[model samples]
Target: MKKLISLALALFMVLSMIPASAEAAYTQAPMLDGMDLPPVAERMPVEPMVEDADYLQIGTYGGELRRAADGGNWYNGKPIEEGLFRFTTEGVAEPNVAKDFDVNEDATVYTIYLREGMKWSDGVPFTAEDCVWFYNAVCLNKIDSKGIRNCHKDANGNPAVVEKVDDYTFTVTFGTPKYDFIEALTVDLKWHFAPKHIFEEMVQCIIDGKNDEALALGKAICGMEFADVGALGKETLYYFWNYPGIPTLNPYVLSTEEGKNNVKGQYYEYVRNPYYWKVDKAGQQLPYIDKIVGVTVSNVDQKLMLLLDGTTDFETVGMESIPTILESQTQINIYEWAGADWGATQIHFNLNVEDEHLKELFNNADFRQAMSICVDREELAGLLTDGWLGGGQAAPAPGQLGYSEAWATKWTEYDVAKAKALFEGCGLVMGADGFYDFADGTDLVLNIVSVADSGAADTYKVLEPYYRAAGIKCTFKDSDRSNIDNDLLANAVQVMLAPVTNIGDISIVLKPNSMVPGYATNVAWYGTMDETTATGDLLKLIELKKQLDVTASTEERTAIALQMLKLHEANQWTLAYVEAAPAYHAVNARIQNFLENGVWSDIYRDMGIAHCQCWFIAE
Candidate 1:
């Protein structure tokens, strides 16, 4: 096995990339105003991936791409900051920082190989030690870890163990077979590696109980740019934005200027990372653009205005901005793509509640089904997506692995009599004004909550009167996104009507938090194997997930996946789903290798941006 891997590595090094076009084989990089860089060949990985000459044109390296930061997930700058194993438009994993990988027959162990000479923006070698440091010191460490480490843990409560094979290769082994590793690694670029040389000393000091010294050194290490925000002091450096000293594998590096504030500043400037490893077919280092300027607009409206005025080059088409995008000039290309989605708009019931009647009423499936029938989805879709997208439920949105068309419209019809039947069955009666009261004639007001920013407040404006027309009096409440999350975690929430946490990847089922909530999206609704959280009808889901964890057979895994989807289907625990609209992107003609039709989801951290390293400025 070792000999085979070594031979494969040699072949990879000698591999020649042939671009579709017979163009010049090499080119000089754009001269930086005051900076000098080594030749592109000297800086790239030993085996630079030759881009598909068919999809992308071989390029000259220059020009800046301008964009705006719409305070949304992915399709933002997350791609400019690339990941190790990037996902394609179809969600297939492609090596970027990674060179290649292999799995044992049973899928219990995975050996991932890194590109030789892969370096961070700071020109430090990226090796297996970095991967080990990140896994041990940051991810698995109880005190310093921020992630739930759920994906890395097994059914028996054993975590995936990490072992370094060499400077360039490492193996991750789960107690059971974990087929979801590939999908999980590609999502959100959750590559578990970092520059050990950069963070270890100060981290060691902190571990040794030198508090003040560590704190002071921590601030220094992050440099003062991230000092005020404590970006440097973060447990993991994955998102320590603007900390120039923080080494990264992304194609671009954040500006470290003392006063550079992405939020307050007019724009945040990201420069090309000279150490970027990929090259075009013509052998030029990748990311043809010299810089990317993310215009910092305070609100979505301002961000849209920038795109409309032609100051910004690209952005996702917010459902609200469809008309504007359509009316734009011919220079801009627009395309519709489905997000890897769990569900869009969903009304969450706080299962763990203090208010007795409200809790019983919310936990009632008949009442929940009634609420689903109240809204005319055709009209709601028209309002939210302008009739461009439709057909959904509490189940996974279309195109996800186990989506069943039969379950989509099961109870989605706008039937007043049927809704009245479901509501009345839950011990509710209508008053003279057409609104329902309790069996004891107590007026019922269902308060649905949401975060103010996601336009859920606006969605509520549409749903409030709609529900009232169905003899149900419901009100809308808004809070910050963080507050809503905190409320859910603390079990203080009553009802949350917001975007159902969409799963952009199949790994979501393995993690299984959002749609089914088996493993803690927020105080599991059905319950989980973990004794701390309540267990419910969803135990089958937990069992299936565990079985999938240990089962090596693909056929068995697929069958189990289908079973899990069926469980969510029967439960209807999540009340309803809104349409999954195309992630709207307005691209300028100057941008090359931009996919007109693509799957853009945050399931892979900023899923659509995985192609960003391949995207370059044609101007």
Candidate 2:
């Protein structure tokens, strides 16, 4: 009865995201740096993803932007791919490779239009045939599927009906109204079309009744050994991004061969695509800059060191990096995007551990809630961010649509008495040494596994004392990133501190990883495709999320989202600390159109909703 009431209220407070209205009509975009195009109006597309208002300058072409990557592959995703749609500063989904789209009244039928003169970076014409090939031949293939995309499927579990209308147009029909499809288009991994020319051999094999050969062709195209093409199919086909022969739609094409690339190499390069479609107001091709240079540093520390030393042009700087960067003598502009990336530092209590006693205690709601209240969030924030952020927020940050104060404030108190009561109920007793002990006369020890990094090591230092004050012995085990990843998926680590991802979006609850057993401990293994692994509350969440995908009512969707948050709050599976904080990044002051207001994201591969095409450096 109590659960029902809270869910009812949460449904009532659902956020109605007001989308930005389109401009009345297309207007000629003005150049930012007051530079003119090279008179190539005849070569430009009929329509381009225009940002006339955002351009701060219209500068000349021919300067190389020097940036640092932690590893070799970072530049491929950052500079090489462009999604069908990109989310603008106003949180609206605007067309990118696609020109425009229309949906039927029932929302089942969507018609998409392509920019007529647009071509792949290799000078091949982009057409409706390419999109249809991507949908039917690539995405819906039998041998190895990319798995069914949740957005493209309907309530009845039917795949979208795709049809090619003409050279520059195509239609996708869902079984039901799919509102989330638009936003899904903005994500990088949601590639709607692949260049059919490069994979023609695989397509031909599929048509000629040679599927094994087709699969082999797919593997070979991705430059992999035949042994690596296990049943997973094309999931490993990331080789297409930098495959020297494959055509791309990005502003710059990778100039280096994939085999020769080295992570520890001093530098790599990307040259401009002559067939790039977007143009400036003055009729010059977009991507005013001619080249993108990625300089590889040995480790994470070197990235910061180079940035501070004024050697690198751009890199993300965290809050902990602020005091140090500010103290540096380099004249840099620090763009402090506050609450741009709103994830919390959280500790997941692994409920699937092999130890029966620990697992049983962790599964108890009271035990979980008590641990939630045991932390001093104010102190954690002070130690981590020097007091810039921390007022007790939970999984969904304040800016997200589903954020609830009730959920955020749940069990967030430095209550010693309450923690003692809750811990006592779980069969833990106060020890002679003023710490908690089990019935077996052993001190209660919490082993927190973390990636061995300077930042993570610093966090454990603060959390250890907080647990100690509550009569529980605290210990931290430093594990490398590869080990932590394996431990989380294999359900090996009993407890670990990880930053909570998928914040600021109510829609994210629909994803299988976050709310399921795969990523975090203490949650039932219910969200995976294998339904037998989960039951009860985990199953309930899965059903609610499916309903969210199909439900038409805004209030109803909000209620469902709120119910999930409430369930997570009641479960208290994670101890979340410090949310809605400022995230900082430093760009070379000479770079233009890098940071904007009201838009920030943490994921680096997509380049933080990157706009490298429009950025230019003055001479």
Model 2 spans > 4 angstroms off: 1-44, 72-80, 141-146, 200-227, 230-245, 257-264, 340-343, 349-363, 402-406, 427-458, 461-496, 499-540, 553-560, 602-606
lDDT of 2 by residue, 210-265 (tens): 76886677655544434433332443334354444457787877664653333335
Error of 1 at 618 (Å): 3.1
- What's the TM-score of every candidate structure? 0.86, 0.78
- Over 1-619, each residue of candidate 1 has an lDDT whose tens digit, in order, gives 3213344334443453333342245454565434676655556666656666356666667877787754322334466555567665544565656777888876778898887777777877888999877777666653232443666665676878888999999988888767667655654236677678877876676567666666676667654433222233353354544445667777777666654434236666777778877777657776778877777677778777787777888776676676776676546776666565555677777654666687677667788888888778878877776676574676666666767777777788887788888988999888988898888878888777777767788778877777888888877778765466556666667777764354334444444666444454544242122334335655556666777767666688778878877877786777655755557677776777886666655555543343666676765
| Alpha-carbon runs more than 4 Å astray in model 1 | 1-28, 33-36, 71-77, 142-145, 205-214, 223-236, 258-264, 328-330, 352-359, 387-392, 396-400, 428-447, 469-475, 503-511, 520-536, 606-610
Q: List the residue pairs that clash in candidate 2.
A: 11-559, 32-57, 32-58, 33-57, 33-58, 34-58, 35-58, 351-522, 436-471
* Model 2 TM-score, 2 decimals: 0.78
